[model samples]
Target: MILVSGCTGSLGDTRTNDSTDDPTTGNPTTGNPTTVDPRACEDGTVRPGRAPLRRLTRFEYNNTVRDLFGDTTDPAFSLPSEDVGNGFGNDADTLSVSSLLAEQLSTVAEGVAQRATATPDALARLAPCASNVSPEGEEACARTIVERIAPLAYRRPLAAGEADELLALYSVGRTDASFDVGIATVIEALLQSPDFLYRVEWGTSDPEHPELRRPTGDEMATRLSYLFWGTTPDEELRMAAQAGELSTKEGVRAQAERMLEDPRARKTIRFFFDNLLPISNLADLERNAEAFPTFSRQIGALMREETQRFLEHEIFEGTGTWASVLTAPYSFMNGPLAAFYGVSGVTGDEFQQVQLDTTQRLGLLTQAGLMAGTTHSNNTNPVVRGSFVLQKLMCQKIPLPMGDILERVKPPDPYSGATARERYSQHSQDEVCRTCHQYLDPVGFTFENYDAVGLFRTTENDVTIDASGSLPGTPGTVSNATELVQKLAESEEVHDCFATRWAEYGYGLTLRGEDTCTKQAITTAFKASGYNVKQLLIELTQTDAFHYISVASQE
Candidate 1:
């Protein structure tokens, strides 16, 4: 996780001006010490840093199989659950292969092979010469099919020996059964290959920098497609790789621009936010229906869709800036969601765009889905809600509450005359609780106007709600959700935190001290571009961190 310490400062400052700096590390003068250029530490030196071999996440596997064989069965759904790292399941470090998973892969591969060759026409499409009467013609057709499909499945051109080995498998199946069986056998083998299961990336030494290395064109294509599309490269992208179009920054940008315009890019954008805000958990969210009569499993599904639609409109249809997303005063809602928000004029199942009352709602923080998802089933929990803002939005590391404190911080009593705020005020009275809640409770208190299920409420037990709080190091205090969101929108710390999250998501690694310079360059460009998300993505693709690798020795 990236930890932000202190107030926002100049990200681009690469000079040391401390007088106590050692002679070997600072300026080499005796009389008066001057600022030393930090870039002199071999800045921009490309090296082949560590790139872990990653297995395809469940989503990636399902999507790639869908694209490859047009199978919509979602085979990976039956596989073992993946361990999440760096806030995403796709992180290479956590995707381990277990014995059960290996067995399931073989079963899935066979099932997919049967589905792909279910009909004569489907088999014909896959292997054109399968209908040929002569054995010689059938063998020739099998070779052609292997040669054509293996590269796409492997994501690189297959070696001659590899192709021969696959051909040998087909020949064995043909002698035992028939031509179609031979084709299905080949498909099963290819699907089970490591080349199909894992994304393999390694770097070759760069001539200009002997110690550094760069990804080959094919490897670059795979990286770009997975980063932007969350699946394998299409035929067009594969052609570009084979033609060496991914070898330069300009070439990569052209492909990225084209891919962004495609509909598939929407999937990647949604995937990022789904994990970031984590709407996926809402699908299975359980609530006390007896207490909150209107809430149900169906309402939870609608809530997820509402957030996705709102995000899509803001990101793609509107200006696509961080400011627009944070302060947008509108949301897309269907009958179920509209009823929950107490908004009128929207009926039926389809989500319609509704203008929000700025006094009541502002951006994602006020959205019913997020607000409801963050709270408990029966009542609101200030610590959970406040900790989310501090850690995820602001990138501050708040230590988890210990066992003793967790035992003491009891839930607020709803039937009591005390309001939610009054009931939870014990934190300020205890030393152990006050240490963290001093920073958390205030931020969470701003959302008290929304109940456990995110319905607007003015009072609890007939007592007025106090949605007032102060953000540490920020000027003034906010009294409501809208003011808090507006303050966050104007904060440089929030902007840098957002940028840091994107870097972690895009690069698939935790940001370390060595990455500060690269992150600074990206954040500087992000600010210069008015925080346009699309432009920020384009800028990230061109950074040295994306295009070149650092030497392992340096790492």
Candidate 2:
């Protein structure tokens, strides 16, 4: 149960061990560190704070097994869903293994190992030596396989003792079954090993600064593969690590650039957007059936696909900038989704690029999946929509209303007025409620032209929709969703927040004061690049936060 430094950080500036909240005060209390290293970040160098041990998410695990043993069965789905801490499922702090998860892991590992060693072709792909050798050579062949596969599985070279442990497991299997079964036994052990399950990095020492430690080349290779490919590193990347190419920032950037061009990088990019945006489970999204007769689960699924395709196209195929993501006057849609949106002539399941009518829609903000996912089943909620844009895009924290305040300030009924603006006007009218809603309602009101299901509307209850609202930092009010996204595309706050989110996703750290300098440098570079998403990803690899680590103890 050895924990890393900063493993239980408080919601404060100081590093402390007491992460529990005080019952009376409702504020976290800090405690002195159980152990401290005298050599700490001193000269204002960018502090690469320690991250907790990371277990692979279901997505990562499935991708890894696919690349590792050519098993595309997606065995990891049997495990529990990950806790989405700090806006991402991959956040390390909340990835601890539960007793249920531990039981599920054993079942999953057994199933994957059985499939991997089932056929002769699979056995040969894993270890040719297993079949080529005679009866006496079976044990030797097993050793050869373990030596070769264990490093790839652990993502680092195994110590002599670790190798012996795997060989011992092989012996137990050999005693019970055939050689292939023995190999299966070894595979089961490898899959369930802590070395295979958790990314445990006890970094190598730094001669230049004894206080700071850095990830070994192999560890860096693991980071690069998971961040870019969302899977295990290929042979070329492993060789680069073995050759000491990942020790320098330039070398890391070169590898990252090459990895980004691979097809697997497309999946990684889509995965990030899936977590960051509101389109994760659109197929199961609820909607008022009678209000929209044509809306089906299939259509909801198409809505999610449209958003994913739009993101992949903009970041990779289009201009590859934040501005393009927010203000592009085009989207990808299939015949079904097109028909759902009332656009004609699109005729199949495959998605194609379609020019949007710029007057009513622009970029991701106007995407149906996002709009529908954030609103209610029967009516649009301005408070929910506005809070998402503010907290996610603007990085503004909205404190919860105290006690019975939320009960007293319930959302206005949709039938209370002819238009959504009139119905939600109490948010601005009430002095107590206006204090918090003022920051949210303005930005949310601009999307009033879109109904609960995100279809464009000119009127509600025979009243013309008035979608005019102002943002806190923008120069003036916007006329509609299109104009609002345009203003957001030009916002420095939006750019900075986008950069911060990427850093958090890439490094798997909840950024703090220790990461301030590092975060600032990344945002500065992102702005300089005109908010190019690809360039920001490369810039993430070149920072101290990606290359170094702070160990909690000598272990």
Candidate 3:
């Protein structure tokens, strides 16, 4: 009766063939695509690659428990921290369990189970058994409780032996203690099960395409809920799965649309941007008090909230376009941030939408949070700022500097009669450093107007700042941060890169070579939707990548 937790191999253990042959051109009767007709595969019939088993991240765990049991204790805070993969904490491949984590899970499960059954109302909602019933009736009530709650906890129907095992646990508890004790024991066991801790998605074989497998309705429902709502499926979503509504593209779209309109959608959207822009890390940003006399943790927190509020207002309340996100002339600011941005009339602690002076601020790229996070404690680091733009915004994979190259290529001192721009120019001089800095430094130099703390400045060390720079392959030169954001707003590469990033985040897997067709389709649809962020999310749920899974031959 040992329930084996589904511990698969390492992240890179799975091997996928990088065949260029399209699956659509193959014979329908046979699972082989033809090599002759290149156009036959262009109809977008590629099978989706398989996603590894995903463990819920700390944030996902907390949100899930809060939604699942109306518990707000945030027990996952005691769990080990999660590693970031593909720029997101939810990557399926990187999330793994260790012996320490297993012990932590067991301990947390006991506390959560006890809390869930703390009162008669709570016990009734969860187990619905009579307190003063006879022993036989108590056993019957325990069985009923196990049968009712296990599916929601596991996110799927129990297997043949699962219910009996839980009932057995309940029997031990009833004999040893009380009926409530029996139910709590079952609850504790279910919480620690692999089915609860991991998103165990295994697709059923597609009869029409034998080589391809489609996720079960329950699996798709779980995918949609976690992706859009950041929690387990609600009653309507669970009903949709049971009724087979999640099996069709139209069904998935309807649910996605409905969920997107709900208030939870705003939380999900904010979570995505929080990972994308990574403003959440600002809470831990350190600064020198002498260098930044006014900086404080309170200001750091306010900066994060400002960015989140601005994103939500634009995507949900306004037009929701990428252009508006990058070139919008307004932002949300509070008293502290307003002072930092050099804006007036915003006097309260609450964040209010204020129009920006086009000369200084433009879009998210110029936000104080991003500028401050990508800088050093005392002075601005153009290399860090530039790398953030190229790697995060454009999806370029920049290699890290090896050995002493970083130590050697240092910024010039302000007292040495050099501007920040002039200091970073030293990287371009050394042939070893120029290989990478040639691509990074130029783009970072465009943000010179914003200091390390993200305050707008005209000069450093009495030298007029030079914020002019150019992005390679872009049409025009950017004289300042405003122009840089505008130029990025109009670039097709930037749009597609953003699309690629969202795909990775939404799918919970890195975009591989085999995912080229699906990635391109998402990018195409994203472009057609006028780069609307909300529309792009709905469109992602409708793609084959979201519905179908590739089946291994042995399976």
Clash number for every model? 3, 0, 2
Question: How well does each candidate superpose onto the true structure, as a TM-score?
Answer: 0.88, 0.90, 0.89
Q: lDDT values of the candidates?
A: 0.74, 0.79, 0.77
State the displacement of the C-alpha of residue 242, model 1, in Å, after optimal TM-score superposition.
2.3
Leading candidate by lDDT: 2
Per-residue lDDT tens digits of candidate 3, residues 188-301? 898888898988878787888887878898999999998898788889998999999999999999999999999998888888888777487787888988878877777888
The order by descending lDDT is 2, 3, 1
- What tens digits encode model 1's per-residue C-alpha lDDT throughout 101-125? 8889999999888888787777766
Q: How well does candidate 2 score on lDDT at residue 508?
A: 74
lDDT of 3 at 435: 59
Which lDDT tens digits does candidate 2 get at residues 230-316? Answer: 888899999999999999999999999999999999898888888777787789877778898878888888998999899989998
lDDT for 119 in candidate 3 is 77
Regions of candidate 1 where Cα sits further than 4 Å from its true position: 1-44, 47-50, 131-136, 402-406, 409-417, 551-555
